[model samples]
Target: GAGVSQSPSNKVTEKGKDVELRCDPISGHTALYWYRQSLGQGLEFLIYFQGNSAPDKSGLPSDRFSAERTGGSVSTLTIQRTQQEDSAVYLCASSLGVRNSPLHFGNGTRLTVT
Candidate 1:
């Protein structure tokens, strides 16, 4: 894909279930990011991956949330023991690098925890 791509555009899961969101960045983009937006809320940074460096997971709200990027191309976000508060649209974005470039965002994955 020429831009970021996210899968499972919509997901409905019971509370306590686990879910995984996938993202495929542009062919040569070296910077990738994951963010979450709750209803009526702003985007919250979740994690960031730049090249071969260790991903910055400080934005993750809990230990239950984790992410990883492989081959500097694909990334995945895993949420454990989902809660109602976890319901939100997960967005993935990519750029040539962290600076001097606009990010290309994917259609988010809308997650609903019942």
Candidate 2:
């Protein structure tokens, strides 16, 4: 894809259900990031993966949230035991590893918990 691509652009999961969101980063890019922006909330960093090393998963809100990147290109985020409070727009971004490089964002997967 020319830019970041996220799947299931909108997800409406019932409370207590589990949902998985996927992301495909730009080719040749070595950095991928996952962030979330909820209603009236700022962009919150969820995780970052770079070049096969361990992913920076510090931003995950809780133990129920987990993510992984395979082949250093595709990534998936899983939210277990979803709750209404988890509803938000999950955005995926990618960029070159160069210092100060800007990120290219996907349209995002808007997950709405009902």
Candidate 3:
């Protein structure tokens, strides 16, 4: 893909269900980030991965939310025990992992937790 790619453009799950979102960053990009945008709210940073360094997960809301990047390219975000409040657009972005590199974003996965 020419840009960041996310799977399942839309996903609807019942409360308490588990959901997994996938992201494939642009080739050669070394920085990946996950963000969430709720209705009428700004994007909230969820996690970040840069090269082989430890991922920065400080923005994750709770233990129910987790993410992992494999081979510094593809990434997955898993949400367990979903709640209505979890309904949001989950976005993925990638960059060159350099200072001030611009981010390329995917067409986020819209998650609706019923």
After superposition on all CA atoms, how large is the RMSD of candidate 3? 0.8
Kindly list the per-residue Cα lDDT of model 3 for residues 17-97, writing each as its tens digit: 999999999999999999999989899999999999999999999999999999989999999999999999999999999
Give me candidate 1's TM-score against the actual structure.
0.96
What is the C-alpha lDDT profile of model 1 across 75-112, one tens digit per residue?
A: 99999999999999999999999569998999999999
Q: Candidate 1 lDDT (Cα, whole model)?
A: 0.93
Q: Using Cα atoms with residue i matched to residue i, what is each candidate's TM-score against the true structure?
A: 0.96, 0.96, 0.98
- The better candidate by lDDT, 1 or 2, is 2
Clash count list over all predictions: 0, 0, 0
Local error of candidate 1 at residue 33 (angstroms)? 0.1
> Poorest 10 consecutive residues of model 2 by lDDT?
1-10
**Best candidate, TM-score:** 3
Error of 1 at 46 (Å): 0.5
Model 1 stretches with alpha carbons more than 4 Å out: none
What ranking emerges by lDDT with the best candidate at the front?
A: 3, 2, 1
